[model samples]
Target chain A: MKGFLLTIISALLVILVLNVGYYKEWFQAKPLQYWTDFLKEKDDTLSIEGVMASRYGVAYTMSMRIKQVLEQKHVTNPVILFEPNSYLRDSLHLYPKIRVPEPAVFYYYTGLEGVWINSPDTGKASFLVRISSKGVGLDVIKTPEQRHQLLAFYKKYPPIL
Target chain B: MPFLLFIFLFICYLVAGYGLLTIFKMQLKTAYMITLSLLLGIAVASFVPFLLQLFYIDLNPASIFGSLVLVALVLNIPTWRRIIKEGFPAVRRSFALKPFRILSYEVPYLLIFGFFTFVSIWRCYYLPPTSRDALSGPEAIAEFAVREHTMINSFFNIDLWTTNNQFKSPYLISLQMICKIAGFPFGQVWLSVVFVSFTVFLYHALKERLHPIIAGLLLLLFLMTPEMYAYTFMILYDYSNMIFFFLSLYFLFGYFKSGIRSHFYFAGLLMGIATYIRSETLALAVLFLPAILLSQRRNKDSLAKIVKANAFFFLPSFLGYYLTAQLWIKYYLPIHYDIGGLVNGHLSDWQPLFQRYSDIVTHLMASEFGIHLWGYILYFTAFLFVAEGIFVRRYSRDARNWLYAIFVLYLGVGALGFLLPMMNLNETTKRALFKLLPLAVLYLANNELLIRLSQRISRWEGTPSYLFAREPRPAPTPIAPTPAPAKGKTAPTVAKAAPASASRPSPKKRKK
Candidate 1:
């Protein structure tokens, strides 16, 4: 009887191990998906960027793209005033349908500073992120007038989470 | 070469840990000694780099490695003296190797736990520190510390308005700095050491309470808890905080059962370590104080002796809190943070506290969505609790004690929300509750019904020696004949630690 009980438990534990992803979510992806994706990839291309790209697929790409634009444009200590998640996601229907990550996360990904409309220093932003019917693009505020005008318009939307 | 360096550093940790435990002289099985020493060793060595920074010493590899050896040597001074006095080989001979007698029932649990552990370690190794909490706080600080060779690196000059991670304890910072300097770029493999050691220690602890099969089953459930398991790899303070806090309570329970002073101090040291990891733990440490103060028998132990015992147990955490706050925040960081400003201002209002507790129960504990978050572990606990209430109608001493600790932990985290308004429900309260799971598992292990079933299973398997079956030895006259706790055979007393104070010296001085 003890053996029977042990066998039943052994089987149950194995089943749980295999199906861990059924309940466990790592981020946007299930844990099983992450495992499958991780195991399939070869380690021949090991780098910090590769690891970021692997864990965060599209969100990472967008951050790097913005970073590329900033570096090419020679914007130093780039402070980006971000459009709210409701506007960016619902209005623009952003690719991947994911809301914009808050400023700290953005800062973590790309060393450039990010600020939401509700940020205390939000109006002092050097660059304003604007969304058109086409897609998301970085809008450089050349003067205090443009920064103020943009902040006034952006404040109408819901605060980015 | 880096792998070799990792191994070398680990050996230093082992020696340091072994020495510390040797000084304490707590009687534990070889397995407990080894695993606990390794974990404690890692924790001890983590402080080295931080201490160097506290003294304005550079954090280069050469400085870190040299300081490690020096610290390890200093910690093991007594042990080395013992070895010299009693010949090294004879002292070594005393430590006879005890092979782990793994029964057939334990095989499945071990295999799966081993597999998951490998995955966790690999992920931790392969990935950089990308968690928002770490990157924003400790990891960012560590990266710059390595580059600049100081804890007060350039990471702090930037505006850190969105997160207050900069103010966290330097425990992770110190270890991450040491590991990064030692060549593990991610600087998180130390977590792997902690994880493996804790699992072994917890499993051994559970086995002593019930049959291996039942223990294994409960542990397997704990291992499979979805959200908690994610932390095994993820670099966070909560996991380590939970381990030390639980172990402290375990030893505290032991002291309660055995009437041993060493056990009392050992429990304090663990709580101190936990407090060092997360300073908020110092507040939670007070909840267990009532248990200690109340444990004194009426009129037998003097008020002075009782107060001294309570102070000794609470002192380590106070020291730990001091090291965390005064050294790290007040001195090390180049920023001004109002510690008092972080406290919730509306203390008179009970509404927020009630709201905080409601969210904890509705969203984190009993809600259907909670099953998705924490899986069935909470439900399993609730089920066992109901079963015990209906059928058994009796609780053992340990079970009763465990339930008290679990409630203390639960209400403690909820109270933290009231105390610190910044502590959110999903992240702070949710993760802090990870400490509660093991205590609940212990409660299950001590359940009368579960113990009874485990006994029946063991009897069927032809094992006579089990929990509650052993002959009661005569109460040997203890140093203090303070009343033997009315344990009611509930606590699977793992051999009452015989020598209370005569055996081990008081805190630091060699002999009493």
Candidate 2:
């Protein structure tokens, strides 16, 4: 009887905690539906690139979602590179001679129109994003060369996502 | 499909581990043996492909699965027989949830274990593999292994061979490779399995020696340890080697306590695996050799008997090293160190070596991740053991000496840490010291001094130090017959014997 009661209590406790964890998004292996919805509002025309973001968390997840969305939308030859701390790496084919600017808080993402979005805080998303030195919404790429540059640069670096 | 594969592979590992335990006749408690079996399962699974690749066998998923099936069938014949004979009592016992008998007073310890278990699972699942050495070593090699289903290194883009020492041990990379073969992305579950195994085995080992409440308390201290908790999730060979080290000691202790041949065999197998896990564990041979010799108490003067018994102890480790690590180090290592040169020529730099030792000692005493008060108690008791072993000399050897032997072996490794070049002495030394923590805890919990101290403290507090004031045995078994003391020599009073059993014949008598 004692063992039975303890088992019941333990089961209840585990179920309660698991429910709380799932509600709070504390569990990993986020569903494909979650990822799809996460990138559903992303700008289709704008190519995205990032530096020094987490490999498994935001950057990797977001990049994979972008790729998934591009394929779903039937976009041709889309580039979505999100290599963390690549600016510090020397083995990349692209940016061999170019100066790779180091980010302040270890994340740097920018669209084709130079609209840079980065988190000032580590391990958390930052809503106050900047385009160069000014704030901007998710904007469209103005020129074909800019889109081509994003694709070409990512083609050279080729993130592992 | 991948998730199902993960579950299937996990079940296969458990079955294989259980089968191996039965084949070896290791009489661990049901829960304890389950953990041990799982560990053995993975080791055997990884080693199958590793051994086959050496024999030029194709190592794709189909071939590896076939190998696993063949091996399982052969081992399970004995296991199935044991089940039929024992009527599946142990299996039923493993699942039979019992009330925590000491739950009233030991709520804190239970809570701590609960929190640590939850954290271990949470860390493994939620925290992705992100360690730098992880990417460069096992993950990189595993990627290559997955792409090309052979151990042959043609597909590897990364220069793991020419540059890194991380790829030297086959256990970690082979584990990742096996995970890929099992159709999972990587074996993230491996670390958690090992972590829990170490904890369960430690509990069983201590519960065998001390009271259950005391064992729980000491395990709480272990879980509270910073480096241990941190590395519980990280993909490093340090914890893997620590598990092998703990199991080696466990079997060696059993060998000495029970004077059993099978225990010696198991110890040797574990030690060999330890050496394969980390080359540094080769130092453990120093501790094991003496124990193997001494544990064969009746053959103390018989050279031939001693040699034969020690052979059983040495053979498995020899196979463990030659099969995996020695093969990798010989052919794969880009820049092998001149070990003889390092030992002989490097002794001149005494000042720097001493400095590194000092740094390691200091790191062990640091507040964060340090076992707090228990750490100091362990060190103080360890010093007393050193003095007793050296000065008294008449102290008859016991299972506690097994702990002392390991303590001394760790000291040698700690000092050797200073001489190695280009290594981060602080971080490397700190991690190395974590291995020493469990050994020290076991020693303290079982030592005569600590037992007396607990008694004294209990008297002062007007309460028992341990909830149960009886000698704790993990399983209900007969007390092993005490060996007759050698003529003109007194027996070691400190020796802790296992439950009742007829004493095996002395090695000399066996030879006759």
Candidate 3:
């Protein structure tokens, strides 16, 4: 038990050193620097939502924001057809690179149906997201012509991984 | 997080795992015993959700928790009986802590390991899974499984053509399902249990052969590997698959040393768990046969016995693939994932095999993976191989066998890439290659020069015993299928699969 306690003390010393390393940025990519930050963030860092915001940033917020817009329009069963990842990432020139989550992941976030451009069920899509210099905008496709036009425009770009 | 219930669940793991260990009559140091208890317990418990689903049991909190209590109760009968006969005092004496003598050299390493584990557990626990692999597959399925109280949920109603991840295995889904029902919404902290236990096991395994300082440094190198460290938090099949595959080999190594049938079967069981985690591991499990045959032949076993031994060693993993793929995926799920489509149709050319093998050598071993992902661990292992080749005159049996296992993993992963179209270079093959590091580290532990240096260090420190060198045990009875306990007697043979309990014998004799 004495040896175990000494071992703990030594470990504590090591932890102390790591905290110092992180504080000083002694090593630029110092190991467990986030751990020190996580420690000080104990109270503020309680929810997965905050972590998601920090990690996914615009991509996460943009999807959720779209979800809110759909809900406000009473679109209970939304079939979202998203712009191709290539267009969103490259052509749109979104800062920090918007990594468009796949349809599966999009569905995971919003609990709504999502289909990429080449998806077999893209014809079932009821909504289209168009990105421009103004901002990300969602449009309700009232007819097959509108949906097909959006699909034709999006397919001209590329597909999401 | 329902902290109390989580604590209760862990206690259940300890009790159930301790029971299983007693059935094997396995003994170990504190770290190894506790670690294996959690791992073995979690492995056994992973099956419960599957069985419940088979019987059409609800995957709700009450039913899930109830099943855990039942399984824990059932698995613990042997240990309970042992306790009933011996009384608490004797039991306490048996499990008595060794006099506290923490080596000064071991402290910093312990701290560093503790720090890494903390970061890992938090990221795993406090956040929703960020990996597309999990989100698109296991995490998505598990989230709905909790809501609907069934594995067949609305997530299956969506587009799944792009992936066969849902068809892979129920291992993660089952564990995550249980964790979510238990209280954790993310259902991934069980990974933390595995990470902590395996790290402790690996450290001890290394420390037995190398000095504490050297073992600590090697472990630091291992844990610091960026991708593997990221996996310590991320929920993925490969991480668990790597741990079990390594343990299966570690046990197989023990079988080679002790000629114990139980260790062979136990290794088979672990390999089965690995296969349960990833169906493709069945193919890799088949790769272990040559090593087993070589080891048994050197043990001078008869051909028939050797065949039977190999069968015992492989049957669980075969059954693992069979139950998960052939039965469950074939019949149970609502969706049909084209599993056969994953096989390569271009088998005749034999071109891709060499191509993939070379690509694995160049892309995985030399470039981005070696630098950014693995740090210097692989390089260090390669350097050790070169140094040993140049300087060391002879290899120990353990070193030789570990190198064989490394050879098996390297080729097996490359072969898997060629055979399975789903195994992309950047993902499946890259992760499958994680299996080599543990084997390589174990090889480093057994390296003759390191052992000699470790012994020298022990001598310099005035320790009574050399670290790696062991006093041979009085030969135990060989290879009985000792499934049942012998009327309060110990299991047939002690495999010494673990270290440090052998540091003293009588107390353990009474304990066992």
- Report the C-alpha lDDT of model 1 over B1-512, residue by residue, as the tens digit: 77988998899888888777766655456667778888888878878988898899988989989988888888888778878888796335324456747777677777767766777778777777757788778887787788899978766665567678888988899889888877888889899999889888878777765677777777777877778878887888999999999888988876665555666787899999999999999988999877876666522467877788789889999989999876679876888889899899899999999998899889998876677667777788888888988997877566788899998987899999899988899888888988988898878877767767766767777775344221111111122223333232122233442121122222232111
lDDT of 3 by residue, B1-512 (tens): 56777898788777777677666665555666678889988887788888888888888878887888888888877777877997675345434566767577586887668877888888777877878788888888888888888888898888775566777688888888878877887788889989998998888778666777667777877887777878888889888999999988888777665555666787888898899888888888898777777766665677887788778778889888988897888888887766788789988878898999998888888875456667667887888788887897667667888898888888888888888867888888889888888988988887867766666666665563344553222122122233443233344344332332253234443222
Q: In model 1 chain B, which range of ten residues has the least summed lDDT?
A: B470-479
lDDT (10s digit) by residue, model 1, range A63-159: 7788999989787888887788767666667623655655656665776678887777775688876656666688788998887777787667776
Question: What's the residue-level lDDT of B486 in candidate 2?
Answer: 34
- Model 2, residue pairs in steric clash: A52-A85, B226-B369, B478-B499, B478-B500, B479-B499, B479-B500, B480-B499, B480-B500
> Tens digit of lDDT per residue, candidate 2, span A121-150?
211211211112121122234455654554
The best-first sequence of candidates by lDDT reads 3, 1, 2
| Candidate 1 docking DockQ | 0.32
Q: For candidate 1, what is the lDDT? A: 0.74
In order of appearance, the predictions have TM-scores of: 0.87, 0.66, 0.89
User: Which structure is stronger by DockQ: 1 or 2?
Assistant: 1
